[model samples]
Target: MYTKELFHSWVPKVLQKIFLFVLAIPLLVGSSIYTANMGDMYSGLGTYAETLTFANYSSTIGMMVGLGVILKIKPRFKSKNIIVFAFISLGLLTLAIGSTQRIDIIVVCSVIMGFIKVFGMIELVVPIMFIVSPKGDRGEFYVVFYPLILGASQLVGFLTANLAYNLNWNAVYLMSAIILFGCALLCIALMHNKWTAKRMPIKGLDWFSIVSFTAACLLLNYILVFAKQQGWFYASMNLRLALAAFIICAALFIYRQRTAAIPFFSLAIFTKRRVLTAIVLFSLMGMFTATSSLQSALTSILQYDARTNATINLAMIPGIILGGFICAMWFKREGSTRSLLFIAFSCFLLNTICLYFLISPVVDIRYFILPTFAKGLGMALVYISGGFYFASSLKPTELMGAYPVVIGIRSFIGTAFFSAVFSWGLYQFQSDSMMELANGMDTMDAWVQARGGGMQLYASVRTQSTLIAVKELFGYTALAGILVLVYILLHPFHHLHRRQLIIRRKRLKGESIDGLRAESFDGKDITATAASVST
Candidate 1:
């Protein structure tokens, strides 16, 4: 039977596929609702911006933990039941997020929602993968898959922004909860409660490793998010203690992973050169993407309210679609990874340059379109290319074990660290600019007196200083992008198609292809140890 038939026999196969796709939408949206409506959440909850950052960090960490354990979790329950439970739990969490005034409660709920949401995502993604690539060719599957995921994310961001703009920020959460609950009902009606795979006993699940890793991540996030406000590491008692706790937790988790009979995830994956290279590339991508946070500050400086800012972000959708199209075409041709990285960084450089020149106190909103589009396109390219690169660097058995580490580094750890650094840099530049501009202002002059005295003059200075600070940050980012692009040009890289051809030739000749398989199919040494199997 086809995978679509697994859903239900009453409907046509095509219709079942469509139905499953529709049900998947709510799961996707609910997973990222907090991030899409970040500005509104800050306003509604009356909390510091760091609180929201912590909430996002918590959710992402939870996602990492979920992905780590999902293999074990899947065998214990039916796909349909997992979907139902995930949706109901996420729906209630959505309500809880909307109902609460306490940031702590919202964060706790976000972490739990993040964990359960993965179960639902897997059920949808696996069937969709079967439909997209029945032959189980990951390259072919990703050509279609990346675009779908990125497109949905951009669309969700735009819609949620509009919802928050039209109603209250809390309304977005309410809408999400309603959709989730509705999906739970649809799952009950449309999907069967039969297990798709044979039942396996759950054993040797290292729950301690998961908890320790999560605690370490949260502690590290707490330090980053609050460092600026608390006066960095040396000045704050809480920050110092958090750092100590983070070290202990991280050490414990690493030790457990190394010594435990069934490690939560294999640490051996990190020993590969290609995997390390992918991590560096992903870190750079994260830093580039984190610059988008400056858009909020820029919009606020331009006196655009939340709604207008959200409207401006809609400009990214077209670029996102275009980027996906490019990736699909690139993968179809089995293009060079170097060429992809070059194009991606070029887009980022262009985005930074555009924003650098466009940061004025008074500028047309239309001026933002090109930069935002470039930003969106760059993001899509990096995300897709990075995932493919990471996957190619590992063996099939190692893929699942390495997934959480790659995702955690790419999505949470790298992004959060850079975001905090950018925030701190912006603050420092703004402070310097403020003092310099203030020193130059002649408050006693007749023109200044005519302009409503000291308060008016101070406001003008602050505005100009903010504009200068933003421009400086963008300029620095552009320089960094240029260096990366040059490195890509100088690097020795082979086309993925060429590598695949070599592998095929080696296989046909009955030669040992183990070395090629060990290192992105690049004909490397095969002496590397295999990844440890998780129990």
Candidate 2:
């Protein structure tokens, strides 16, 4: 009802801050909800493998496109104004996705929704960075913001699933749209026009690079998602197309980056060992947080309904919030980030190990609480510390070009690859277990069961196979965790102790360690001894 100019001039400071917070809430939550409840969407769209694959692949492609656009545009408009339009776009897309019964239509809507969601997410942060004054003690506010968004998204994602299941599934999307629309109005009312930053001119955008990179990303994602279904490399047309597209586009993209005056990505900063280390950490974080297999185990083997699953996800938030708080406090106290990462990885190892033992068809939901909480805590700690570590590793100029590619790999590629691996593992384990069980069956008992076979036999076999597969997945994850833990200890902590001891012994004889200062991945100077570099 209010004009933007009139409302911005008259709004109170307290009310404007409240509006800012409100606007932030919806940006990331829908994307989380879509991801967390994908199985539900799979069911709603009639449980076709091809449909789910295309829907997911299309959505991710759209996200890459949107990310490209965001990176290209830089900061041109009012941040709040960008958010307002983004939310409205999301609302419309959500409604369109929910209203459709046809899988094809839903897939189209999802792609658009993904595109809009990415745009919304990137824009959402711009306003906060611009408007929120991080002076003196308030400097930690910026550090805490992403985790806050993450926690909220997790909570809302679960709640959205619960709502979708209890009422009509479509209702959740419609209600979300209405809520976002209301938030958009509030943004118009509260955000002022005076806050403007110098934006990079749009003319500098590398369109060719954007297109090539997006094509490569999309093709790669499609292959990852659909390779098993398409029989991998030789059989499916999809795989063939994906491979050809990916190879060509990737080569072109690389060539452009090397040659262009204004490349879409500046790969030179990645020459730093610390930046590469952060990328590895971020990728691992994505792999660790790929919870789809775990959720599938709960739903398929343990028979948890949507509401119960939602409740379990909801329980994870408190632990995540606690971890974030701990990290923030530790950072303020000048606690070592390397130590925090060790603690985080240790927690992750614990979570994976616990889940490895605790998962079974007969296990109750209560058994998952501790392990899930640990997972959440570890995730938050890694995310918070890792963000700080990555930021500190770079100069201010390096931040812009470095983040998009690193995050693209971390966010999309890491999860997609792990999910594919998990799915393949499940299929392989299930098939092998079924074969083993079949071979060991008693002849007379098998004959009787075969003679009386119906829903009961099928259900029993499915449940058993699924249980075996899930347990195998947990075990595999635990083994992977062990490897990660060994890496963490060796690279970050264990080696540092040896270096320190060598330095101490050398200093006792008045050795000159003054020329030994080297840049460490933890954003500190390490006395680089001969032994340090060799290791």
TM-score of candidate 1 to 2 decimals: 0.90
Per-prediction TM-score: 0.90, 0.85
Question: Cα deviation of 273 in candidate 2 (Å)?
Answer: 1.7
* lDDT (tens digit, per residue) of candidate 1 on 418-508: 8888888889999999999888788899999998999999898888888888888888888989898887788654444666778889889
C-alpha root-mean-square deviation, candidate 2: 6.1
Top candidate when judged by TM-score against the true structure:
1
Tens digits of lDDT, candidate 2, 1-535 = 2232213756776666566567767766565135555667667767655456556656666666666566556456555566677778877777777777777677677667777776566554544554543342222543467567768877777777777787756777788888878877776666655434455556677879877886787678778878777777778887897799899999999999899998876779788766777888878877677655565665666777766776777667877888868876775566666688878877777777777787666778887788778877887887777766665556545665676666666666777788778877888888988777667554457664676654555566767887778777877787887788778766653135556666677789898877555333332332111111000
User: Would you list the clashing residue pairs of candidate 2?
Assistant: none
**Pairs with steric clashes in candidate 1:** none
On a 0 to 100 scale, what is the lDDT of residue 252 in model 1? 100
Q: Which stretches of candidate 1 lie over 4 Å from their true place?
A: 1-5, 492-535
Worst 10 residues of 2 by lDDT: 526-535
